[model samples]
Target: MSDLLRLATAGDVDDGKSTLVGRLLYDTKSVLADQLDAVTADSALSTPDLALLVDGLRSEREQGITIDVAYRYFATPRRSFVLADTPGHVQYTRNTVTGASTAQLAILLVDARKGIRGQTRRHAAVLALLGVRHLVLAVNKIDLVGYDESTFTVMAKQFAAHAAGLGYPRDAVTAIPISALRGDNVVDRGGRTSWYTGPTLLEHLESVHTAPDPDQTPLRFPVQYVIRPRSAGCPDYRGYAGQVAAGVVRCGDEVAVLPSGLRTTVAGIDTPDGRLVEAPAGQSVTLLLEHDLDVSRGDMITAADAPPALTDEFDATLCWLGDRPLRRGTRLLVKHGTRTIPAIAQELLVRLDEQALSLCGQPGELVLNDIGLVRLRTAEHVPIDDYDTSRATGSFIVIDPADGSTLAAGLVGADLPIQ
Candidate 1:
């Protein structure tokens, strides 16, 4: 099992994501004494407002809402955690995407009173598109609904069905009742509901397995830098420095430099500690090739036998995030891996209707927070993969060249059904 777990909390506004995170931090004894003291002193209530611990922004605290992705780190004896508390408002759905982009799991909260809302379904669809494998449906504020067990059960079944329709397996979704404010079933299984006999939120987080082993996937190493330091100990050291995005790389493995399709053998793997005989996915190392090639940043090094396709055109699912509307012929930059290329929105196929949980037939333009299917044409052929096959190689960002701001988050070859 991996020692670190990356997760995110998301839902509608006032869903208590911050409070849940703060409770996790507090109950796990992860907060510093001075930090606790400050929050305690700042609170007007008898007890410190736990939400203040995560709602760090003055605007968020003042408005009593989360507007950005707030990341928190804490640990228990069993494992460490990095949780992103994402904003829930419809306009800030982009932040939720940013927060959950790399998360292996997501805690999708629902008010026991509201049941399943449109934004909830939309967020669930976006999580599916992002390929987040594990999901926890946290039916929060059960106290508001008089701690009705049937209400929780009905919501869980409804969400489970929706998640299933979105391609999540039965075992991938787990539902738990929680009250972030009261600290029930968060870190501990409180006595409020003896009718429920499931693990606490923290217990589930600690035990749940997530994501397939990256080492089992094909090798994908995008060269971030080329190292050729001329030193006394190593006068002729030439290596490609990058993080192994997927699969295992061994010393003798034959690798292919992408776009150029130049083949070479892995001469060795070097790190700051020393040379390594083999390096697996997620490890950053300097790769020594048998033959020196014109490798640079944006070029990918992959297993020679299973190289990704080089293409100038591909279909993508885009989450439109720009303040201005997006339409066909909108010239933008597609930042894939480390490569940036000029691209145009060739066609806007359809937009996702969050209310109906279906695709809009002929949406000509996409506004902020509108997710749609688009055909992108790049200026040059770039190495890309299917998102379901390799997230590291298949994801790209659409950026506005004028202001150098990100306009959209894209997934290559993923046209997920909203339903």
Candidate 2:
């Protein structure tokens, strides 16, 4: 099987994100015949309206704008893709956060006529905050601008500088000029503007390096269940079952159970497929430990050599998604990995000015779709890692305890700008 690449689309409305996604699926032959036929039947133009393939909602089709995140899966000979076509409306920026949370790369679309809008900058900042290292600036509608090389060049330079300010490395960002409606530089390199030499969007998608390898990072496995089978054949089987969040775990390796600080050894690795010698990140397996400590759900199993610190209070950067404002002293639930703990919004540090790409001191409260830094106090000690070290172990969601609605997506450590 080919390696998978998780990516998302972002930018202002009418930038043709849905069209671009639909174009990709269409050109790659990933769309089904019935789906294409339905779109073709609904289309009023000479050719089939590709955007209809992704804009599935009735409201979206009527308004010709994306309001929700639409996910599409496709595969090429070299790689597989999970593409998230995120919303462009400011109110739906929270949905962009959701779509890009697990994305390894983001394609920030921009209309050639209107270079980069404020929402584009905001989405870029959010992508940076989420640790999406790779980016592709798809400058759409080049045909409307007469395929001017200067237009694409100027916009690419501006975005490159902005991405640098956001801490993206030089090679992490790529610029491609294309007309999503015309299918230029999308799947294949059409003979339009021979001035451009960059790879097509599909080629780039197939070859670019993806997110960091979880198996190479520190071990972080939060036990979801303590498997104790009472069957007649195996009466003494006690294994901790959960997905490996990061790093690799091998049988006989020394491990540490968090919150209790108990040391143990991995006696064996169990899987439904049969016993295994080792398991890497992203694998769901049962770990049989040498010592049966009081490990349970919410307890973390980590490599003994480098275990996370137990903490009740920690600073985090929040992408507030709540409909209501997030004020200090508000009680919330912090769901990290397999554990959920009661926490309070102890302090609001600063809010990000996405357009200005700067911090706005300390805000009284974080409003809807606000990205801010805050301090949180948990009711119990939880093992947490910095997002830079482990994306799985360092990220969490803030839930409204009253209604259980998710309020914000949080990164364990703040990625703040230098004042």
Candidate 3:
């Protein structure tokens, strides 16, 4: 409860995911009566259409389940939360990945009556690969299963086995028995599951901390825009504006500006409201240097001691999300932070084996939602770090210059040279 938490709910269809979220919002007083009334009518009684609690779209209301990722915000007296309620259908699996991408904690729901399912495994793999540190397995619909201790214990063990296969640390997984429909063990310790001793779903969520300072590996700030103050009061103001990709940056620190390889010292750091002595990852502050340099929007600002290498060749993992198959010689635009470069898919090394949890030697082409290791060649040099070290600088997205839709998310590889 000390800091804000970001979490996503994922599971198979009809697992009471929407209901659980609705329960959280309702018990926390985050939902209004008018909305509750509409849900009641939609359900034809007190047993409201719980899916409507999250699938706010009218079309989704007609269908009675989520089709796209639905975002909801709620706050308790102790902590604030941003919840991403992802769809359960297989076709909308991408929605789960999209939701889990930014989540620090993943709430994976299972039907107490049904136990664990394949969708659970798939979602768990994505969460693990994306570096989600905290995972909560919410076994919903416990009341339907008569609040049986065996039911919960069995499902928890089954889930733990599969999660272990995914390479998630054993201590990272926590399972809680819940009845989303009856509001049992959601925000409060409901009486139905009194035999089970564990914190409520909300309690676990409030305690999980997932603030990642990936920028701590090194100071790397990709300039999004160059601000030139031609205003009357500050006509001489020239600065670069962007979020720090990694590391802490302070005024007077020796810094390097790429790709011209110019060295300079930080004269000042300023935000729109005022000047600052330092800035770190997640801060969108502007930087003013001691000397005027030819830094532009695509340039990178990095720490002098350890900086990302400017390179045109690299190995990366690409999860293809487009309709077209990615093969060698395919041209795409790689966008890392604010830098975009024309890149070619040199090779598709191995197709991810989700079932075996191993990479295969050969695959024709990566299809939609397929994750694979890949080799790429860029037209211009872009400084980057491995995704594990600096998420801000290490990640990139491939785009089709033809239509501009996002195709794949990339992570820097060990093969890339460090400057």
Indicate which candidate wins on TM-score. 2
lDDT scores for all predictions? 0.90, 0.92, 0.83
Model 3 steric clash pairs:
215-246, 215-247, 309-419
Q: How accurate is candidate 2 locally (lDDT)?
A: 0.92
Report the C-alpha lDDT of model 3 over 29-54, residue by residue, as the tens digit: 88888998887887755577666789
Q: What is the TM-score of each candidate against the true structure?
A: 0.93, 0.94, 0.91
What are the runs in model 2 whose C-alpha is more than 4 Å off? 211-216, 417-419
Q: After superposition, how far is residue 362 of candidate 1 from its true place, in Å?
A: 4.2
Clashes of 1: 0
Tens digit of per-residue lDDT, candidate 1, span 189-279: 8787788998899999999976456445788999999887878898788888999987889999999998999999999999999999999
Best by lDDT: 2
lDDT-based ranking: 2, 1, 3
Clashing pairs in 1: none
lDDT of 1 at 122: 86
Assess candidate 2 and give its TM-score to the true structure.
0.94
Tens-digit lDDT track for model 2 on 1-419? 38999999999999999999999999999999999999999888879999999999999999999999999999998999999999999889889998998899999999999998888888999999898879999999999999999999999999998888888889999999999999999998968879999999999999997745534577899999999988999998899999999999999999999999999999999999999999988999999999868999999999999999799999999999889999989999999999999999999998998777788877999998888989999999989999888889999999999999999999999586322
Residue 56, candidate 1: C-alpha displacement in angstroms: 2.3
